[model samples]
Target: MNSTTDDTYAIAIVGGVYRERCMRPAWQEVYGSAGRAASAMASMGVSVELYTYYDSITEPVLISRAAIEGFKFSGESIPKSIIFDYDHGLATPRIYSFGSRQSSLRVQAEQVLRFGMLEGSATVHGKRVVYDPQSPAKPEPFRQNGSTADELALILNYREARLLSGGVSTSADLIAKSLVLDGHAQVVVIKCGPLGALVHDGKSTDLVPAYRSRSVWKIGSGDNFAAHFALRWMEEGKSAAESADLASRATAYYCQSKGFAIPEIFESFTPEAIVPSEAFRNGRRPVVYLAGPFFTLAQLWIVEQARKDLTDMGLEVFSPYHDVGCGSAEDVVMLDLAGIERADIIFAIGDGMDSGTIYEIGYARAKVKPVIVYCENESQENKKMMQGSSCLMCDDYVSAIYHAVWTACSL
Candidate 1:
């Protein structure tokens, strides 16, 4: 809008800057909401600014990235969240929040800002509000932290939309329209993970299909999507629907390359073939048969956690531990086999190389069902035949689960 580029930034991200410690598959570093979004936008040569809260005492490696890819950062003094990211895909990263969200900032009209009502005390002078409800399950969370409805673009996942809109309908169009018509938002963007995204601007809704990446990296994906969308729609003045579609492609690239390589242009960039994976197509979710042992406490925990994880990801699961308990040998065998037959995919625990679990995997394979084995520390000799039979054996637990679901959804 103006030639005063030094005084005006194209995008402004207000979120967090904190430590992220991931376990099972271990990785420890400082990664935050605004920190990531700013980095991503800056990587693409966007003039961006980040506003966040972090421990000013220790002064963690906040943004010492490549010189050209660095953005302007304003950090509030706070011992912020130390998020524990575990291997259990179903579980949310446990945030050990130390400080209160008491901060303020000036929202310039020239800047495209996305604030989740983090600091309700701040004076927002922008034309539109960018709302991210943070988490749906926070203790009485969505209390309108600090957002206006007029000309608001609401970015939310399925759960947040459900919490705000009410009811249990999974249709993105219905949920988005309800928000728009009800005046919760002028524009509603429902991020449906693998099923793409729904962009609704009161008049109509469009489903921007998600491009399947070779390796699906879950961490910071939402932040990447939101930043790219802000750049395209808010900064560059693209339509909501077109911006959303472009954002989806950008997100796929982020996942595929883990934000290492930045494309020159968003519109012309095709990291890989844009193959859409419909996890839920025509109101049908592929059934997943969870085959694993429950003899020991450790074994039982894995099986239980995996079951919940798969279910939370919106797949109907037939877990032997939950679906069928202690029973006669003949009955258990028959029931488990029946479950396997009905399932579109089989996720088996191959760590212990349990006879029954192995049998289930073999049976599922014989019956032409897709099988994913989570064998973290099993020998190659032991899994040779299963591998030979074309079973997808994954050493990482999370990868195994995702592989199974993706395989099943594609099928």
Candidate 2:
């Protein structure tokens, strides 16, 4: 058994730490997953510290569980973050409008950095640091601020990377170069969901393939990847490739179990046992636009299942949910329209009167594209406008998919 004092390696996590509220299907409160990465690292038996700013609503339970110690700055009020997750769907939308509250967090991070320098303790001064810019808007504040650590890891998703790179390139190598050359950080990791991650270590880059899971809860998968990778590389004396492989497996476990805690089975897990999901399979196939409302868990599940089934039938699927999340209304509209324009056919789940799906149906019709509508419980009210010569309506999802496959073949 490893105690905090016995652990030679230590980690410092700096990012948004707040309370999260779910506003879809039901209203419930949960801890922020991204903010809880320190705890995850601590559970792995590495001494961990956290530098964050929080308010009264922030829970103290995770702090003790995940970190050996923490430094917190008090804000005027607690930031309220909301997530719209539906049954562990891949595209869980989030609204993290933290306003000006995040601006002060960088100051707290700087203080922690200075304190580490003054203390000069092995755990405090030599700790590997993880800076998780929770949003695209939050990166600028930390970009130029000088913070030093034994090794610094910046964890970001594709969108956040694009924002930081000024839309130049989303490549992990390019982002890392920008960060290193610009004096922002020494190492960069760009996590592309489902496709895995790109780890750039100043000189070289490695592509880590994601391990497949039967069910996916993508809420905190990237956080798990970043934290575990840092632990393995810094604490366990593993190479970049080895650390990333383990981190990928750890993320797979987190997603599969839908738990914030790291699983014991991941310690012995290897990539050889992984079987990539059909979505990750490479081949040329007709692109089908999966147009529907993912506002509910049931709807998101249906869309996800349809995507997998359609992909299994050798048809490429472009799902709006997979691409867009908590963006501007214009961005959402433009992205969906572009996808519809690229797709050969549209598969819409018309269980209810989803305005967005209805608009997609009309758009596809105007574009002279074939539209397949699937409604589980048939009703005359919902079928009036859908009854047309160009549309195929099916009560069963499988029937709709078969019709879509046949339609694609004919085209």
Candidate 3:
């Protein structure tokens, strides 16, 4: 048997095998999986220790253990924290090997057995376990066939607490409820994007509405919720029921706000722990400029596609062709130039490298407003002009459009 005086609960955070890609390494490496969970727990005044394991994607060999023990053996440490066991199919043997050979399944089974053994030991020893059964892949409406293989494995079978996190849409909420009804968890906290969370303990479910706010940027909102809720639950010694309510409110507060500042209630929950709604933060909308020739239908199509994509990422786009009418070349150039100067970032189509497009590129460069060039196909003249400009030369319009949106948002 393993033992220690650290006195903090060992929390594990799993899931996000695919989401790790969409986010920058800075988001993961700096705000690590374990670190984010710990941060959430800390907000509730809970001292915790966190453990994180990435799904699939083989890692380097390390020491193996047979005994199911606590952090004393695992070497993880934190205060009383929420354990985030993200339910990626990567953890189970049969699921991981669904499309592969039985040999791979055998290896996965051994790993799960070891994990279960260790986890069982930890529970038997003494530690409050909270499991976050979320994944990067969006949960589909429980397809009998698609989720069949996943169901047989029972990946989330052992969680005492379930956190509905990471892209929690309506479909995800239903799945979270099913997990609870199925006995995979004793309590369920459903993270409802702007609305808040729905928390359910075996007997009852409560809809905890979010604290209202003005500004919003939902980049790492789920991570923020997991951190604050976990901390508040552990530190305050609140019941799972109370924790669910608090977590929902915390997530809403963070999502409605901006920046990564840790909330104060996490350290010590006093009567004042529940703060006013206006305490949340805000963000300024980004300004965008779309420049290109207005003659060709193909070029017009590319511009429209770019507009749609940029709008999706939350930008106030300024395109003269759309705002004004797609008129003569001279009129479009004049309007495009004016829009370019007022904008923070410029995405110009270099399909033809028309004199106007070339002039706009030079103008954007002169203003230092980050110009991104999009070419429909390989044109020597277009390629030469795009060389020094912050551009993406692609074989087709779709690629160019995607590159432009990505580049513009990055800046």
Tens-digit lDDT string for candidate 3 (70-188): 12112222221222222211111112112211111011110010112111112111233343333423322222212111111122211221222232333434555676666544555
How does residue 124 of candidate 2 score in lDDT? 23
The model with the greater lDDT, 1 or 3, is 1
| Tens digit per residue, CA lDDT, model 1, 106-223 | 4444454454533322334455446565565641222244433235677788888877887546677888888877767788899875567889998887888777666566677787
Badly placed stretches (over 4 Å) of model 2 are: 1-9, 23-29, 63-127, 141-143, 170-172, 261-263, 268-286, 289-411
Per-residue lDDT value at 131 in model 3: 36
Best candidate per TM-score, number?
1
Kindly provide the TM-score of model 1 when superposed on the true structure, using C-alpha atoms: 0.86
Question: Which segments of model 1 are wrong by more than 4 Å?
Answer: 1-8, 57-60, 66-68, 79-89, 115-123, 138-151, 166-170, 264-279
What lDDT is obtained when candidate 3 is compared to the true structure?
A: 0.43
Candidate 1 overall Cα lDDT vs. reference?
Answer: 0.70
Q: Tell me which of candidates 2 and 3 scores higher on TM-score.
A: 2
In model 3, the worst 10-residue window by lDDT is 104-113
lDDT of each: 0.70, 0.60, 0.43
Residue 373 CA displacement from its true place in model 3, Å: 24
